[model samples]
Target: MLLVPATAATIDRRLTGRSPVDGRPALVLLDLDQVQQPADEVADALARFGAGRFADVRQLAPERPEAPDMDGLSLLSDLMPQVQKALDSGDASQRQALKAEVDAVLASMPEAPAGRDQPRLDGVLKAMSEALAAEDEDAKPS
Candidate 1:
């Protein structure tokens, strides 16, 4: 008789739920490393990051790695149209407003250790591309 390994059970632990604190935007950053980490370790990181800062977080086993809810997906979906406009119009002012929104989302992350590289979030990339293009054009020595 052949023996087969049993599949791992899914874990769905929510550290925090959606919050409306001061009407500011909420952000969730998944600690990808935690997928393989022990529950205690994952809980510690969640506790550290969710102290009135992060709006939601969860740790799921690899067998069932999935987002807890559609809130984040909804946020990205709503922002895509605005991002498209900013990218198409190449408008600095519009990009600035969108950048502020992105900032609010990033404010949920814990302060990085000194000298650590910052993780680039989406939506900001389009603005960064626009800025770099302008710089390149300026340096063309026309």
Candidate 2:
């Protein structure tokens, strides 16, 4: 796998939309070389950017040998549409209901067989997608 240097050009477009990054988001500069990198490295190079700051590798795994970040490609593809529907429906009740469904999926992981934690992550991804779809209840109503 190649090392896709986390440069200013690598800022995730999703983050930039939430808060316009002046240029070259912070995460772009985080150094992933400090870690005991895997043979296949699979560097993520997360840096301070968008709504947050501080840089770190998001994850390092051997199974995925992609040098370029694949964070945008979520495993919960099936659940994303449900999340999008809830968000666009303008139905708070529907969104909350979806969140509960997502939580239940996550909490079920403890009973899952060991070494199968990927399913747990799948649940987390689904839950987060649902939550992200929500209008921040604390935010003044848009």
Candidate 3:
């Protein structure tokens, strides 16, 4: 389990492709400051000290009623494979067309409410755009 000060909404980023050192499933504990209960506090402390200290920790699947609608984020994730495919084809015109499509989708996405996830989402989107631009440069004939 990874304990981070970041909001829980960004847990996806932390857990993606992560593997446990002991072959157990990885878990992420977010927003340590928000932990309210004594049991949780002890667990958090133990986790911070060392994960190996605990012999058995029950994994609880809790519902996130506060999770924001992430349809735009999902759409962006879906578009990435297509973007890579376009890049792999090495067709300049196709790349431009797909870039335009991405821009359109980005422009059309609704403004997310101001919160912990919003900045992270914006950063991810910006990084994606910048990466595409970089890839475009790399693909150009020298």
- Identify the leading candidate in terms of TM-score: 3
lDDT comparison, 2 vs 3, better candidate:
3
User: What is the lDDT, from 0 to 100, of the residue 72 in candidate 1?
Assistant: 50
Candidate 1, residues 1-142: lDDT per residue as tens digits?
Answer: 0111123533244323222333222233444564787856666776586664332323321234344336656666777687667657766666667766656665664654586544333335445445535544554666
Candidate with maximal lDDT: 3
* Weakest 10 consecutive residues of candidate 3 by summed lDDT: 16-25
> Ranking under TM-score, best-scoring first?
3, 1, 2
What residue runs in model 1 are displaced by over 4 Å at the alpha carbon? Answer: 1-61, 109-142
For 1-142, candidate 3 gives per-residue lDDT tens digits of 3432324344444453223334433455543456666666667777777765453234544335566448856876788788778768877777777777777766766777675355455555666666667677987789
TM-score of 3: 0.42
Q: Which is better, 2 or 3, measured by TM-score?
A: 3
Q: How does each model score on lDDT?
A: 0.50, 0.50, 0.61
Task: After superposing candidate 2 on the true structure, give the runs of residues whose Cα lies further than 4 Å from its correct spot.
Answer: 1-75, 111-142
Each model's Cα RMSD: 17.4, 16.4, 14.2
lDDT of 2 by residue, 1-142 (tens): 1123354455343332211223332322333365576623333332223223432223422355336324424535656788788777778777778777767656664554665444445655665745654464733465
Deviation of model 2 at 88, angstroms: 1.6
